[model samples]
Target chain A: MIKVLFFAKLSEQLGTRELLIESNNIKDTEQLFQHLLKYQADWSGVLNSQIWLKAVNQSMTTKNVVLNDGDEVAYFPPVTGG
Target chain B: MISVQKQDFNQQVEYNRLKSKTSIGAIVTFTGLVRDINQDQRVSDLTLEHYPGMTEKCLIDIVRQAKARWNIIESTVIHRIGALTLSEQIVFVGIASQHRGDAFAACEFIMDYLKTQAPFWKKETMESGETKWVDAREADQQALSKWNLENKC
Candidate 1:
C-alpha cells in the first residue's frame, strides 16, 4: 500500500489527513492522484486549484517519480515558515 | 541542532550553545516573532502546522547546504508550532563560524531557504475571530532567487 498524506490548507479542504492506497497499479504521484479522483470527484477542484508540492518518503519529488510499495507520498502548499 | 517544537525557546541559551566552541569567532542569530498586524489586518493569533518527518529532513538539508557553502562551525535552528499569540516567538536561526562574513551569510541563507523550502504552513486568526491561511509571498521567492544568483557569480 502507498501511504498518502496532505497538509495545511489542502488537508482542511479535503477533510482528510492521510490515506492508504493499493499500490497494485498506482505507479507514481500522478497516477495516485488520479486514483484518488476516481473515488471522490470533488477532490479534482481542490487538487487542481493550486500548484501542489509533492514529496516521496520525506524527500521533495516531482509528479512523475515512480512509487514503490510502502512508500509515503505527501502533498501540500508552498511553505511559509521561518 | 534542529528542533521543531511547540515550546518557546530562550535566545540566550541558543546563543550560548552556538558560542561554546572555542574556535568560533562570530555568531549570528535571527528570531522571527508574531506581529499584531499583517497585511493591514489585525492578527490575534496563529497556528503553525508541519509534516512530521519531512519537516526535519528539509531543515537538515538546508543546514547541510549552508555548511557546504560556508565555514560554519556550529548552528541551531528552532521552529515553533501549534497555537501562537501576538509577540510570540516563531522561529530562530543561529550560526557560528570563524569569521563574521561566513556567519552572517550562512545565517541569512538558511533563513531564506527555510521560508521557501520547508514544509510548514501558517494560518492566522484575525482580531475579529475570522481565520485564514496565509498565502506564500512572492517576495520570499525573490529573496531565495538572490542566493541562486550569487551562487552563479
Candidate 2:
C-alpha cells in the first residue's frame, strides 16, 4: 500500500490528513495522483489549482519519480517558515 | 542540533550552549518573532503546522548543507509550533565559527533555506475573527537563489 499524506491548507481543503491506497499498477507520483482523482472526483479542483510540492518518503521529489509499494507520498504548499 | 517543539525556546540557553566551545570566536544568532501586522491585517495569533518526520529531517539537511559550504563549528535550530500569539518567538538559529564572516553567512544561509525548503506553514488569525494561511513570498525564493549564485562563483 502507498501511504498518501497531505499537510497545511491542502489537508484542510481536502478534509483528509492521510489515506492508504493499493500500489498495484501505480508506477509513479503522477499515476498516483491520477488514481486519487479517479477515486475522489471532487478533489480535482483543489489538487490541480496550483503546483504542489511533492515528497516521497520525506524527501522532496518530482511527480515523475518512480514509486514502489510502502512508499510514503506527501503533498503540501510552499513552505513559509522562518 | 535541531528541535521542533510546541514549547518556546530560550535564546540565552542556546547562546550559552554554542559559546561553550572554546575554539569558536564568533557566534551569530537569529530569532524570528510572530508579528502583529501582516499585509495591512492585524494578526492576533498564529497556528504553526508541520509534517512530523519530514520537518526534522529537512532542518537537519539544511544544517548539513551549511556545514558543507562554510567552516561552521556548531549550530542549533529550534522551531516552535502550535498556537502562538503576537510577539512570541517562532524560530531560532544559532551558528558558531572561528570568524564573524562564516558565522554570519551560515546563520543567514540556514534561515533562507529554512524559509523556503522546510515543511512548516503558518496560519494567521486576524483580529477581525478571520483566519488564513500565510502565502509564500516570491522574495524568499529570490533570497535562496542569491545563495545558489554565490556558490557558483
Candidate 3:
C-alpha cells in the first residue's frame, strides 16, 4: 500500500488527512490521482484545483513520477510560512 | 541546528550560541512574528500546521544549502507550530560567519527559500471569529526566484 497525505486547506476541503491505498494497478502519481477521484466524488474538485502541489517520499515531485508500494505521497497548497 | 516545535524560542540564546565561536565576526538573525492585521483584516490569532517529518527534513536541507553557498560558521533555525496570538514569534533564523556579507545573504536566502519550500501552513482568525487559510503570495515565489533555483517540483 502507498501512504497518501493531505495538509492545510486541502485536508480541510477533503475532510481527511491520511489514507492508505493499495498500489495495485496504480503506476504513477497521475494514475493514483485518477484512482482516488473514483474513491470520492467530492475529491474530484480538490484534485482538480490548479493550486495543489505534490510531493513523493518527502521530496517535491510532479504528477508524472511513478508510484510504488510503501511510497509516501503528499498533497498541499503552495507554502506560506517562513 | 533545526527544530520545529510548539514552544517559543529565545532569540538571545540562539544568537549567543551562534556567536560562541570567536572566529566568527558577524552574526545575523531574522525573527518572524505574527501580526495583528493582514490584508486589512484584523487578526486575532493564528494557527500553524506542518508536515512533521518533511518539515524537519526540508529545514535541514535548506540550512545545508545555505552553508554550501556561504562561508558560514554555524546556523540555527527554529519554527513554531500550533496556535499563537498576535505579535507572537513564529520563526527564527540565525547565521554566523567570518564576514557580514555572507551572513546577510545566507540569512535572507534561507528565509526566501523557507517561505516557499517548507511544508507549513497558516490559518488566520479574525477579530470577528471568522477564520481563513492564508494564501500563498506571488511575491514570495518571486523572492525565491532571485536565487535561481531549478524548479524541482
Instruction: Specify the highest-DockQ model's number.
Output: 3
Model 1: pairs clashing at backbone N, Cα or C within 3 Å: none
- Lowest-sum lDDT 10-residue window in model 1 chain B: B144-153
lDDT of 2 by residue, B1-153 (tens): 899999999878899999987999999999999999999999999999999999999898889889998999989999999999989999999999999999999999999999988999999999999999999999989998988833210
Which ten-residue region of model 2 chain B has the weakest summed lDDT?
B144-153
Runs of candidate 1 exceeding 4 Å displacement: B149-153
For model 3 the local lDDT of residue A74 reads 94
Q: What is the lDDT for B28 in model 1?
A: 93
For each model in turn, which proportion of the native inter-chain contacts is also found? 0.86, 0.82, 0.80
What lDDT tens digits, residue by residue, belong to model 1 across residues B42-117? 9999999999988998888889889989999999999999999999999999999999999999999999999988
Q: Is the docking of candidate 3 incorrect, acceptable, medium or high quality?
A: medium
Off by over 4 Å in 3: B151-153
CA shift of B84, model 2, Å: 0.5
How far in Å is the alpha carbon of B19 misplaced in model 1? 1.1
TM-score of each: 0.96, 0.96, 0.97
List CA RMSD, all candidates.
2.4, 2.3, 1.2
**Which predicted model would earn the best TM-score?**
3
DockQ winner between 1 and 2, please give it: 2
